[model samples]
Target: MTIRLVLAGCGNMGYAMLSGWLKSGKLAPSAVLVVEPNAELRDRAVALGCGSAADAGAIPADAVPDLVVIAVKPQVIRDVTAAYKRFGDGRTTFVSIAAGTPSATFEDILGNRAPVVRCMPNTPAAIGKGMMVVFSNPLVSADAKRFVADLLSASGEVATIDDEGLMDAVTAVSGSGPAYIFHFIEALTVAAEKAGLPAATARLLAMQTVYGAASLAAESREDPAMLRKQVTSPNGTTAAALGVLMGDDRLTNLLTQAVEAARLRSIELGK
Candidate 1:
């Protein structure tokens, strides 16, 4: 369906989603209106051929978008969303990407009848390879949920959760998963340097190895454990490495703990 979208912010995440929508033909430039306080950011949206304004109040009074995306930071979301309250008259669906903010918050501000969607998107969304997870309030129609999913698919894969409480777990995993991978790369690079490789070569080896392994894992028909078995030979170098990382399920346990910690923190922040 053709959707008229109102984007409430034009920051990195906002611009990334906007770019994806336009590039994927999900939404046309003429159908979007971006409201950003930052001149530079607003200009960036304007450059994409979307309508732009310094504030929501500047938007035409008659404008009633099909979707109003609240992409501003959580701290200022209340004030920013208040300006667009007129659009929340049961017609426009509100989608928020702000972490820790719940659909209940929007329901409180925009009235109980307004359909709302809460999404958790990671940094990789900027590169179009992200994992976008969404939860919608019951007021949202099935068609609106599909439209939201279609818009998000432009960024990457999209998943839907029936329980809103699980969002904290989703945030801990996909939302913060990239940082864990990045740290692993750093550690691998340092280990390579200690093993006598030149710094530049070590960095390249570490990066490419991770990238290749991940790509292989993603594309391979076999599961990761089976794939690992395929590469390992008895008493070989790969076996020795696996002996350390897999001993007593050390790595698995460590990652589980890390995800739990992040999930707890997410719950705390939500409060």
Candidate 2:
């Protein structure tokens, strides 16, 4: 069956996902519909040859999409969702990528009968390297779940959790994880500069080092601990650096606290 997807927003993340779907050829432009209030974004979608509408009201009544994707901000969820109530008779599955908004929120707006999938995706999704975590309502069918999983794979890795409560932790981890890596890159660059390297050289070294290390970790058969040990000599520079970082388990402790704080904040935002 041809699946019709209706995207409610066409901002950065939404646009990236749409582009990925089209590029992967998993979805044809004709199979997609976009509703974006911004003229520029709507025009961009149009340029991609997809059906574009400035508002949900502009979408044809006969276009009963199989999946309605809510990519708008959480604050405006209700406003955007009100446009699709015509499909709320329990036939369509609703997918949301708005952070901090729970499945219950979508259920409240889309009607309890609507099958809702709440996903948290990070910024990297724009580049097709994102990690997405999803939680779905009980109403979602097995076939619909598989379809959603396949659609999300266009962005990158996708994982599903039965418990909606775990979404807060997923938000704390993968959703906010990219910023932490970026911050580490910045710090590494600054430190390199302080050690007498030129700013540009430091930046290049920092970024490339992080990129190479991450790639190695991903591709290597060895565990990360083994790889770290392989790089650190008995009393080498890496060992010295590890001494400082591992001393009192300071880095681990700090990261644990940071993740906990983020998870708590995610819970608070959902509430």
Best by TM-score: 2
Per-residue lDDT over 1-271 for candidate 2, one digit per residue giving the tens place of the 0 to 100 score: 2439999999999999999889989789988989999999999999998988888888776777889999998889888888888877788999999989988887787787999888898888888899989998999988889988898899989998999999999999999999999999999999999999999999999999999999899899999999999999999999999999999998999889989999999999888
Over 1-271, each residue of candidate 1 has an lDDT whose tens digit, in order, gives 2338989999999999999999999888999999899999999999999998998888777777889999989888889988878877788899999988888889888987899999999988988899999999998988899999999999999999999999999999999999999999999999999999999999999999999999899899999999999999999999999999999999999999999999999888777
> What C-alpha lDDT, on a 0 to 100 scale, does residue 145 get in candidate 2?
92
Clashes of 2: 0
RMSD of 2: 1.3
How close is every model to the real structure, measured as TM-score? 0.97, 0.97
Best by lDDT: 1
Model 2 gets an lDDT of 0.90
Residue pair clashes in candidate 1 = none
Give the Å error, residue 222, model 1.
1.3
Clashing pairs for model 2 are none
